[model samples]
Target: MKNVYITRIAKFLPNEPVENEEMEEKLGIINGKASKARRIILRNNQIKTRYYALDKEGNVTHNNAQLVAKAVEGLCDDTFNKSEIELLSCGTSSPDQILPSHAAMVHGFLKSGNLEVNSPSGACCAGMNALKYGYMAVKSDQVKNAVCTGSERTSSWMKSDIFEDEVAHLEAVEQQPILAFNKEFLRWMLSDGAGAVLLESEPNGKTPLKIEWMEGYSYAFELETCMYAGGEKLEDGNLKPWSEYPADVWGKMSLFAMKQDVKLLSENILKKGVASMKLAMEKHNITEDDIEYYLPHISSYYFKENLYKEIENQGLHMPWEKWFLNLQKVGNVGAGSIYLMLEELINSGKLKKGDRIFLQVPESARFAYSYAYLTVV
Candidate 1:
């Protein structure tokens, strides 16, 4: 197989950065009261700033597809223009619509040219899925180059209006003013951003990151849903999607709002992530010693120590200095998180030739993970 190189990396962050204190002002307070989980989540996540695709009046500035189109536009240069693209693979947890795939919307926005496009939908690992698809497409000689993107318009879903009916129902019935922690906490955790990279058979820059190997794993066979949107978890541990329920009750139950099983996530996320990494390492016949820069896409800094403990227990312990993360600066952009981190690291002028960058992407949506090895050359 031919090697796939990540040539040009770019990101599109809409509007100015929103501080921790300014979140509720833009997202609005749920139940007309401040979220009890916001402060704690912000403190633990250590995210000082994040971007939103909405204005102060809570109006959308860019849709998910537009965000991706903007990011893809940033990839164009004298060396590679939009017309030169042969494949466009996009991934997102939040799409503007469900019918036309995310990639089609992106292509429509770009008006770059008619090309093969795909959209992989999920949580964090969706971005890796998009990258892997493009990587394989180039490596298999199906195309000379491919453009892959990951983006999220999460702010639209996190706005308080989405939960008004559910919060109002709770206030009317339970007399409690606070929204559910599962849904409310995410409002503080997610942000909006889009990132893109041009993958080619040859390196475009002096220090292009070459994809060595990519692997994805799913523990969904053993674990139930840990995080979800547009659905409800039934008593039997199965999800009831938004379409299954009545249209009127969707707002009442906040069926379209994102939710998580916090306890389940804490118990299984790190444990399963490292366990699956071990399996991937075995298959690749590589060890931690083979990597120089470790980039793990984590939603919160609170999980940093816990994740390290899990790896240490498995004898795959990596020193903190080897770890690189920007969650504190970018918050969590879900599927786009890793792409933003990679864009920053690659443009940071830190990586040199022959460096090995290892990516660990874990999605709590259902305990799926994606790992990739990239070598700077």
Candidate 2:
């Protein structure tokens, strides 16, 4: 089988930085009743800086396609872009418009028509989904090269007034209202960013990384646990309230999704390719000591802490503190988080040729858990 490789990767983030403290102060002024509650939530989340696109009046801006275009341009400048590029796929939850998948916009921006472009809207998993699709296209010999881009500008939908009102109500009641208003709870954590990767059949030429195999799984139980949309537009031309409660209400949703993905992966992919890195490593011609790194999706601080506990319980080797610290610097870039970390690992010399790399991406019901098994080459 021909080896599919990740040839190039790049990312772009908004210039404006919104620190957590700044957000808290702003919210406090806007809704004095919720000042204390908002501060507590912000402090507990431990988010330092999040990027946002703001106008002169301090309103959030939405520039999803523009950022995606920038990332793609970076990839093109770094790599040779032939007119015959076979595929273009964009993974995004926050698209510029509901119509015309963001992929089409990217295709237009790149001015390439000899390729089939797919716009995948699997929420957070969109980017990984694009990668998986590109991998299959190249592995099947259907395409020689492909590009996958993930970009999101969630700040566009942040309704300050509605968010302030919701925050005030929640504080007065001492309870979060519902999923629809949970956006305020997470507003401080989301930022605007974009990342892109170019893939080819093999690294016979210059390239950054190579792909080994990709795996994915979906849990139907999480179908209604999370959702995203334009929301109700107001007369003032702003987004309405966002829903974030169903996910918490269905507390086990993510865990269920994880179990389903792990079960399928262990049986179909890992068992066939390599033994569990935790058990009988030497028997499989490998050992836990052989792995230099492991990368997984960065969901949240709480999720990460719980995941660490779970890994310890399972006796799996824990990643270095550096990996967790990196998350502190960038928060979570959605689908781009894992790939961005992979790029950093390679560039920082932490990864070397023949080093095994494992990446797991779990998306909400809109998408699903998408895993990739790659080796540094």
Candidate 3:
């Protein structure tokens, strides 16, 4: 079978690292019960430092387009002809605007000519879909080469001052003091980064990895309301206008206002994720012995142990030593996580020729999953 090769990968971090303590101070949860909850979440998540598009005072320094442009630029060097780029696929959980597609904006920024552009607009897992689309386009002879990018400025969401006050109000109203949408919770969890890959139908002498097979599955859209941003849905599944929004709904109506049911995500993730992985493995006749590296894009540290156990239940017992995780350094970068993680592995220079890598990514827009098999070349 003709294979799609990853000729090059480039990732860009917005700025300096933002430590947990610094985030705490910025969120004004320095030392209290709220701080304690923040600490526990961080400790369990295992993230140390994450980059943000922010300045020293915790203000957004870069917009989504700017961050994505930087990564796309990195992917293109003197040897890479921007003209030969036949397709561009851009994915993001947070786009700069809703009018012009993010892919179009990126195309405008890079001045990449009138090639087909696809914007897989949805949750974080959209990244994998964008990449798969590019790969398929090349493998099917629709294009000679394609550039796929996943970028997010989740920190852009953090710039809102409403969350801090809203949390306080929610806590005060409840019978017991409870944290709700607290900055400390998300400040340590989300991040800013962009990653891009140039794919080709034939090896360019710069190819580092060859995608053997990629599969994706979607289930649980019935629960799509569990995690959403930008708008509120009415009882009949129609979006309510901003003017008609109720107080509860109005409070959550910012550019990056995300309302999520953490409990729902935790309960359903493993079952759905494992099912998706098992199907991909069975289809490809893959097993633990065939895989050298297990690269998974998990949303949180809380799910790590359970995910391992679920995979074990499937009778594939790959040790943690083989698992590659980068959430500790970059947090969950939404659409950018998978590419960022893969870029880290590639840059580590640890992969040997012919090593098999298995990638798993699950998105939380009510659960979509992507699994890919790649071999180091």
User: Candidate 3 at 251: error in angstroms?
Assistant: 3.9
> Clash pairs of candidate 2?
179-243, 179-244, 179-245, 180-242, 180-243
Ranking by TM-score: 1, 3, 2
Candidate topping TM-score: 1
Worst 10 residues of 1 by lDDT: 171-180
What 10-residue stretch in candidate 2 is worst by lDDT?
Answer: 252-261
Cα-based lDDT at residue 343, candidate 2: 59
Candidate 1 local accuracy as lDDT?
0.91
- For model 2, what is the alpha-carbon lDDT of residue 259? 15
For candidate 2, give the lDDT of residue 101: 76
User: How many clashing pairs does model 1 include?
Assistant: 0
Tell me how far the alpha carbon of residue 188 in candidate 1 is from the true structure, in angstroms, after superposition: 0.8
Error of 3 at 10 (Å): 0.3
Per-residue accuracy of model 1 over 170-230 as CA lDDT, tens digit each? 8779777567788877888999999999999988775688999999999999999999998
Q: Candidate 3 on 1-377: residue-level lDDT in tens?
A: 36799988988898788787877544444214444566787888888888888787766778887777788788876887676688989999889888699888888877877799999988887788899999899898888888998888877565446454455555567733344442335656788889999998776644368899999888865554446765654566444445565656455334246656566677788888898888899898988889999999987888889999998886767788889999988888889999999998988878889899998988876688888899988
Please, what is the whole-model Cα lDDT of each candidate in the order they appear?
A: 0.91, 0.59, 0.78
> What TM-score goes with each of the models?
0.98, 0.74, 0.88
